[model samples]
Target: MISAVFWDFGGVFTGSPFHLDDYARSLGTTNERLLEHVFGRYEANGDHPWHRLERGEGTLAEALEAADESCRADGIEGFSAEGFFKAMSGTSSEERRDKVMAKVSELNDAAIRQAIITNNAKEFGDIWRSLIPVDELFEAVIDSSAVGIRKPDSAIYRLALERLEVSRPETSVFLDDFEPNVAAARNLGMHGILVGEDIVPALRELDRILGNDGV
Candidate 1:
């Protein structure tokens, strides 16, 4: 039985429509090249600068400096961090899904343990609780920005499990919007659900998987 259920904040619970094509167009770069530049094979090592920015540790200025350094290193010039952030800020949050607190309450009522492991800003979380009792929703919430860490990092996952008091990976399940993030949890021997498509399907899939396990 799954004793603890972990969910990602964006895409999984919220409707964050971040598009790569739009970002590339905004940057005047081809999608393929942008992907190679930002998410090269070294992404697993937390080398993808933008991914870290989304987690909220560094300010936009800091990220821009990093990008400038990277651009100079690649012998490319005129990469504007302002332009990149403008495109990023343009991708609005999704309106279709329910807030995480409501969903967690639903799962808790079903007697399943629930928590949130997301790469969001600490400031946003503070504002989020003003809308709902965030602490009451999940047994734990592991925010990468607040912790100075990001997903695909095993240490953060371990922190979540330890906080939830779940020792075995079999007792927990993690759902994330990104495949690589899901893969990280899987590597840790935890059950993982990739939520790249509609989250309703993923939520239903979770129900089926956990239901079969008698959670």
Candidate 2:
């Protein structure tokens, strides 16, 4: 029996506040160029400045300075994290998905625990938390910045499980928009669900795993 369900925050609970391509276009640059200049690639791991910020090893100002330097080194000047994040955040509104929250409520009503594990920057905690009724919706909210560990790292998952008091990984279901994070959970013996643009099917799969076809 599945006793717990873990969720990802940015894409799963809410629409991605920042669309990289859109933001890049607004800045008169291509997503490829922006990513190359800022993050060095589309999917960066622990070594990236973004990851460092998420892991609480550095401040946003420092990360932005590093990004600016990287952009300058690539011969692409005028990179501003402040302007980008501000515009992106402005475009983002607190539009919670009712269906997903309803499913979470159903699971909670069934005595199944639900938690949130997200790779988020330390500075955005208040903004992100305001997007959802986090205290009522989840038993635990594990932000990477607060814990000093980000997703795709098994240690964070283990910490979440430990905090939830779930000993058997098999009895838990993990959902994330990122494949790497899902894979990491599976590696630790938990069932992993990949949430795509449409979350209904993923929720259905989770419901089926919980043996509730009607849910």
Candidate 3:
């Protein structure tokens, strides 16, 4: 039986992390430019700045300043982490994720251990906790920044399995909005779901997997 349910934070919980189109528009450029400027280059294909931000390594402002420095080095001007973060934060107002958050709370029980496995910068947990009592809702939370590894990397997924104490990958269900991350979890032998608006079926699908797992 599925012993655990691992959730991704960004698109799955809220919406996509900073719309690419919005970033592009704000920068007076195309989506490709925004992608190239902020995320196209990285060491070891890792999310360095975001990882640091999520792990509590620095504040949003601090990350922004560092990004600005990087921009200066690259001879690019006017890129705004503050603006980007503001856009990403976009009013934590909508009730779009209420159902899913409530679902997590509803499923809070011993039969199933729940966790959040997300690629976030430092302070992400703090921000999420402030938005909701995440500690109360989840048995564990594996933030990439804290772990020094992000999703699509097998090690981080293994970390989630370890924290949940579930030795068998088949005993877990991983949910994320990104196809690559979902694929990575499946490769690790865990059931993976690509979250979207129509997720009732996915929840039921999870129940089926859990049922089979003997939980």
- TM-score rank, highest first? 2, 3, 1
Query: Which structure among the candidates has the greatest lDDT?
Result: 2
In order, candidate lDDTs are 0.68, 0.79, 0.72
- Clash pairs, candidate 2, are none
Lowest summed lDDT over 10 consecutive residues: which window, candidate 1?
A: 91-100
For model 2, give the 10-residue run with minimal summed lDDT: 87-96
TM-score, every prediction = 0.75, 0.84, 0.78
| Better by TM-score, candidate 2 or 1 | 2
Per residue, candidate 3 scores C-alpha lDDT tens digits across 13-84 of 676653567665765666555655554342234445544565456566665676677655666567876777
RMSD of 3: 3.5
lDDT of 2 by residue, 22-91 (tens): 7677666787677666554424565777778888887878778887887677666667867667655554
The true-versus-predicted C-alpha distance at residue 152 of model 1, in Å, is 1.0
Question: Per-residue CA lDDT of candidate 1, range 34-130, in tens?
Answer: 5455444323645466556656645645555766676557655556756554554454344434534555777899877777887765545665445
TM-score of 1: 0.75
Regions of model 2 farther than 4 Å from truth: 17-19, 27-33, 36-45, 86-96, 212-215
